[model samples]
Each structure stands twice: as C-alpha cells, then as structure tokens.
Target chain A: MKRKPSIVVVASSGGHLTQAMCATSLVKRDLVLVSNKNMLDGSHFTRVYTIRDTQYNVLIHAVNFFVALKILLKERPRAMFSTGGPICLPFALAAKITRTRFVFLDTMSRVTELSNSGKIIKKYGLYDSFLCQWEAVANDSGAEYHGQAFDLGDHGHQ
Target chain B: MVKPLILVTMGTNDYPFTRLYNAIKNDSLYTDNRCEWFIQTGSCEAPVAPACGVIEKIIPRADMEDLIRRSALVISHCGIGTLNLMLKYRKRVIFVPRVAAHDEFSDDHQLQIAREIKNQRMKVVFPDDQFPLLDYEQIKEDNKLSDPVDITNYDLAEIINQKLTG
Candidate 1:
C-alpha cells in the first residue's frame, strides 16, 4: 500500500513544540516530527525523530544537517513546518535544499522580535512562508501575522 | 481528605532554573504538610526533596497532563507549552518567566510572553516581584478534578493549514 505524504515539523521540546502542535492542529495530512526531546507519550505525530539540540553551534549544526538530509529524503514530506529554537536550523536548511515547502512560525515567546533561528531563516530566505505570532514582530520583520497558537485573553475565564 | 496537589514545572529547556527552585523552596508552604507538591525540574538538579511531595527531573507529557488536570495550583516557567496546558485545563497558575540575566534561559523572551498572559486565572511573577504565598484555602477550593478543553486556535490553525497544504 502506498503511504500518504507527510508534513515534517521541526521544533524544540517545549514552547516551540507546543506552538507547532497548535498551529498544525488543523492539518489533515500525516505529520512527522523532528524535535530535540521526546516528551510526548506517542499521541501527536506519525513518527518522531530526535535530533541534537543546539544554539548556533557550528559543529552540532553540521552533524544535524546531514541527519536532516537523511530524514527529509526518507520521509519525502509534502511540506515542512517549524516553530523554532536553534535545532530547527538544520531542518530549515534541509527543507530548502530538498525544495520542500517550508512554513515557519516564529515562536509566540518572541513578542518584540523573531527568534535567533527565525532570524537566520528569514535572512537566508529558507522559508516559503514565514509567520510571526506577534503583529509587532511581523511588522518589523515583514513576516505574515496569524494571531497566535491559542487565545491569551480574558474571554475564557469562569 | 486528600491533600491538594501543587505542581511546579520548570520547562523542558536545557537551562537550569535554580531561581525558581529556590523561590519555591523558600516558600513557607515548601515545608508545610497542608498540601502535597509535584515538581518537574527538567534539566535542573533535584538537590533535595520536599517535605510533602515528589520531585522528578522530568516526567512524560501524558503524566504532566494528568497532573495538571488534578492540580489545585500550578507554578511554571513562562514556556508556551505549560501556558497552553494550563489554559486547556483552566487551572490557576503563577508563571515565572526565565530571564537571560539570571541564566534561566537563552533570552528575555519569556518576559515578553509573560506580558501577553491576560488570563484571569494566570499570574505573572516578574524578576523583582515575589512568588506570592501559596494560599491553602484557595488551593483547597480549586482542587476539583477537571478535563482539558480544546484550547487550540482553530482559526489560526486553519490559516496555517491553508498555507501548508497549498
């Protein structure tokens, strides 16, 4: 049987992964995750690939770049998405190299600016569609604005 | 009567948030027996045990979710993940942003996100601010079990979906 094409998601373990999950919640395609930590109980993705976590470390990024190449070639995702920490750097590079449609959401944590990884991605034109959760950041960086992964207002209190 | 659960999550970041650990450790409730504590310290060292609860470096995400559902109060780093979970469970939370000045995180972005938390159920503790006293009475009142509500912004998700599948 032929397998469905998947979307490869690259995010770090905590906030980035959370935002990635919420931002991708409506996606119906098979989802494959590339993250630094395996915190989940196996509920969210069709497959989870663990990669070394880093922050502008050239050596580690070098190692992860090849790993990213291998994963993308094997999974051959229809598209790729990320909410980032520096770990997403290699995957972003890989997605660009593979001609995968890459959509990136700069993490909601960065209220005033894009993350370091997001900055590099933007500067290098690594993404096909780049978005920011904060409108201010989007305006400053010329990235698309989509409210946020979840509501952060007073509307839901009991 | 069962002791109300107080949950502390320092997030899954590699950074060690000993400031948060010390803050909770110094709280009068840390040694009190009125309620129990469950702390997920992540990369932080578990130097000692609490008088009334368990301390683990980290637990699986499912375990964390179950704990959130049963928790009376949550003290967490201002990671978007913990914030999202608390919102889904509608849990009362005290959020402490991890600051780069203190080496609690890589940057001051947590503080930025902390500013966006307008939820009545959530409280933000700035670097200079005190970690508010844990109210046993308030905790006891809030101890009822709950199920998580779907809190994802489907409108945003729908937009993301369009951009990706297109």
Candidate 2:
C-alpha cells in the first residue's frame, strides 16, 4: 500500500498543544506530533516527540531550533502544521527552508489581536497559509479567517 | 465513591496561582459538604491542611483526562486548555482567572476569558467576588442540573476539515 502523506503537528505545551491537537484531529492522513516534554498525551499519534520547554532563554531556544530542524529533516513531512508558539517556530522555519508547505493556526485566545507568535509568522511570511480563530484577528493581521480551533468543544467558555 | 470528586487545577503554567489554591483551601464548603477533593497543583505548593490528593507536576494527558472524566465538578484557573477539556467532558466548571494585580499572571487575559465563561454553563469566580462555595442544598433546591447546554459543535471543526481536505 502507498504511504499516506504525513503532516507534522507542532506547538508548545498547554493551550497551544491542545489547540494543535484539536485542529489536527481533523486531518485524514498520518500525523507526526511534536511538543515540549510531558506537554501532550500522544497515544493518538503514530509518532510523538518531546522538546524541552525553553520559552525565554535565548541559548536554549537556539539549541531547540536545531532540534526542530532535526525533526523536520527526519520526518520530511508533506506539510508542517502548527498552533503558534515559540517551540513551533523552529519547525516552521525548518519547513520553510526545506520548501515544505507550512500552515499556521492562530490560537483562539487572541480575540481582538494577533498573538506575538502569530504576528511574527505573518510579518515574515513564514507560513504557506495563516489562519485565525477570530475574524477580528484575521482582519487585523491579514491572515485568512478560518473558524476557531476550540469550536468543536468551545462550550461557550470563550 | 464516598463523595463527589471536585477537581481543582491551576494548570501547568510555571507560575503558581496561589489565589485559586488559597481560595479552595480556606473555603470550608468543599470539605464540609463531603466533596472529595483532588487538585492538580502543578507548580503551586499544595496546602498543608484540608488533606486532598495533589499533583505537583505536569501529568500525562490521559491521566488528566481520566481525572476530569471522574470529577463531579471542576474548579480551574481560566486556562484555555483546562476549559476546553471541561467543555469536551461536559463537566460543570467553576472558572477562576489569575489576576495581574495579585501578581498571579503576567497579564489580565485570563480575567477577560473568565468573563466570557460567565455567559456559558460554567460559573465564573473572580478573586474578590463573593461566591458561596459548594452550596449543595441551594443548588438542589433551584433544580439547576436538569438543563444541559450544548456548548460544543461550533463551526471551527468544519472550517478545519475544509481547510485541510478542500
């Protein structure tokens, strides 16, 4: 049987990881999930990799950049999909350099504006396509206004 | 089950949300009403008193999900992750936000999210707001449990499906 195209699903821990999982659960093909250590329960994915959490440290961030690059090189996935976060940036960049298509899904928290991560992706044209959960964010950031990642279980919690 | 499990989580945010932790710890109702308490304290130091099951570090996703599934009520810091999980499980939630003034969070975004949760099925509890914790008799008298709100099934999933497939 022919191998299905795999998309790399990447994010930071907590909300970013959760949003990525919820959104990527929709993908029909295989998925390669990556995030910071213990940030996700990856039993659902065929492959899962954990990167260390280094949000503010410049040196560690640089090291993890290569770590992300390594993962992308190994996976060579068809597409890289991410919910915006610091950790996902490296993978997105590696994917960009490799000419792998990248999709950036802005998390639902930034209702009125684009998050810091989202802005960086939009400003640099890092993603092949950028999607926003809220229409206002899409309007302000010029990312395409896709529906929210949280709507499947939004439960009016906002 | 000796008592309904009331799970309290401050999320896995590195900063300890002492406000939520203290609120539940000091409140007499959770114990007085015989609600067995389990708290995922994360980085927050668990209370020495009130003797509850505590998780001080990040837990695996499945373990977290199982706790949520078993809980009768969930009291949480207004994290999108915790809220999303509660919504997915359709559990009754008491949403509490870490406040900037209290130095609980770097920003007041959680407060904004908590306000929105007020319009939903969950009850929003602000730091200074006077809410009687676990007034079981009053809840039963008011018959509040019968109406189940379907807060899931918004258009986000469809949009993602379309974006990926089409």
Q: By DockQ, who's the top model here?
A: 1
Residue-wise C-alpha lDDT for candidate 1, range B11-130, written one tens digit per residue:
887899999999899888889888899999989997877889999988888899999999999999998899888888889999999999999887898999899888788999999997
True contacts kept of each: 0.83, 0.35
- Interface RMSD values for all candidates: 1.5, 4.2
Model 1, runs deviating above 4 Å: none
Question: What is candidate 2's CA lDDT for residue B129?
Answer: 90
Cα lDDT for residue A118, candidate 2: 79
Query: Candidate 2 DockQ category?
Result: acceptable
TM-score, candidate 1, is 0.97
Model 2 achieves a DockQ score of 0.43
Q: In candidate 1, how many Å is residue B136 off?
A: 1.2
Q: List the residue pairs that clash in candidate 1.
A: none
The TM-score of candidate 2 is 0.86
